[model samples]
Target: MHSQYKSRQGHTTLGNTKTTVAAPSWISDFKEITKMRLSISVVFSSLVGYLLGVDVIDFKILGLLALGGYFMVGASNGFNQIIEKDLDALMERTKNRPVPSGRMSVNTAFIISSIFTVLGIIILYSINKQTAMFGAISIFLYTCAYTPLKTKTPLAVFVGAIPGAIPFMLGWVAATDDFGIEPGTLFALQFFWQFPHFWAIGWFLYEDYKKAGFFMLPTGKQDKGTAVQTIMYTIWTILISIIPVFGFTGTLQLSIVAAILVFAVGIWMLYYAIRLFKLMSVKAARQLMIVSVSYITLVQIIYVVDKFIR
Candidate 1:
């Protein structure tokens, strides 16, 4: 506290007061509730897929897809937080989230989630019936199936992967309003990539996740078996990534050089996965997580550039 008093010669004096300014609590609360960075990154994947699928890109549709994607992902995360408020408070990583930290009421979070879900579907439906259908399904599966199962089974990763992988192919669906081998290949790429990506995260955050009773790893531990499956999925990711170079993905075809570049990054990621398996350390797991993120982005970039050039 501070007080001001009149000084001699009618001068005003102030004592022991300073001000600290921060973003409004509501602003920070919104960002945390939506997991804004993650939602944007998810939208980026969808945009990449849209670019690959479109012959002539429509900027309007692209914008709508981004908005809709963000809303849907945000809604899912919000609902997850609402359901796991207590669980999130139990884990170091998630304890500061809005619902868990008491920065926002659960009812408020639920309303935000429900609104986003509806608006996301309506925006997506403006694009195409198929796109909206997928968005709705993604929201339903993620909140209904994935969130509740997180603490119940190690297979939650498998369940979570379905909605996680949808964003990429959802863009293709947004572009063409069709479902076929093209979007399927894109879906497969993301689907396999998540196993290694998330398993590495699971390994590194094992203790924290255990505090919340989250069985993220396939075998529910950071062991050789989980590492081995990480390897298997990483291999599958690489195979699916390179398949376009063989001229089998229809409109999703890639140049041999792009495929080679993709393969190089995949092997780079695999090297880290092997290190995680051998070292069995959080350090190695963290490195694998970083590489897996880079691998997906690099490969997606390679595919998009290859598509435009060819």
Candidate 2:
């Protein structure tokens, strides 16, 4: 009888230990539903934009911008997962996410996302009206237009790029308190960069995305058509990067040396795109993705440095 009691007690202890270990893992699972890494990247872009926008740095505004940008980007990402949770369950890459994996309730996710949406907008309002409006617009477009369109058509990439480009341009407005040629220039640069960046992502994730019913590429199949179009857009991206060299785009001018350097990076990226177009293999697609990342980061650095040095 004592042996039986001891066995039962041991079982109960193990059960409790299991429960305790599961709890924190569950909370972490919930956080992963928001695509935290992607939001971090978005916040980084916003921070860089904010830094480049202002002549003098104000840590206070930077704090507000970071806080507000995180929530805004987080909310956008959370709602994106909520809307796509069902679809995510079908994709290998996304099937383990909190919502799709049943670690977090969809309703709970929605409520948290909604809360962040409002909080983010209010915080941005504290910075400037233009910033607030831009933040709100980004949320709306990402959730409303980009989220749904992903399953419906390939044009979703184009639609999503608008909001994606806004963060960099947003800083110019946040600092200058107005929309002018400078912001427009910033907008143009980021806008053109998105095509190559996102297309490379789409290309690399094409198989996983197809499982989720997302036709991300213009070709709608992992084929030469898509690769060709990606190369075309990359060429356009390179062209736009050098535009400010002419000094015709208002105060957003780039020096010949800066343009040459920026143009070299662009060509390097385009070379990868060209390789993808020729090879049409996953290896080439992966290289294009790497080059695309390098391209954007380098271009932004060049723009900010040129602004200061020249």
How badly does each model clash, as a count of residue pairs? 0, 0
- RMSD (Cα, Å) for all candidates, in order, is 6.2, 6.1
TM-score for all models, in order of appearance: 0.93, 0.89
Residue pairs in candidate 2 whose N, alpha carbon or C atoms collide under 3 angstroms: none
After superposing candidate 2 on the true structure, give the runs of residues whose Cα lies further than 4 Å from its correct spot: 1-27
**Per-residue CA lDDT of candidate 1, range 1-310, in tens?**
0011111223334686532212345566788899998999899999998999898999999999999999999999999999999999999998878788786799999999999999999999999999999999999999999999989998999999999999999999999999999999999999999999999999999999999899999998889999999999999999999998888988889887888899999999999998988999999999999999989889888989888887
TM-score: model 1 vs. ground truth: 0.93
State the displacement of the C-alpha of residue 151, model 1, in Å, after optimal TM-score superposition: 0.8
Candidate 2 on 118-194: residue-level lDDT in tens? 99999889989999999999999999999999999999988898888888877767776777777777777778777
Cα lDDT of all candidates, in order?
0.90, 0.81
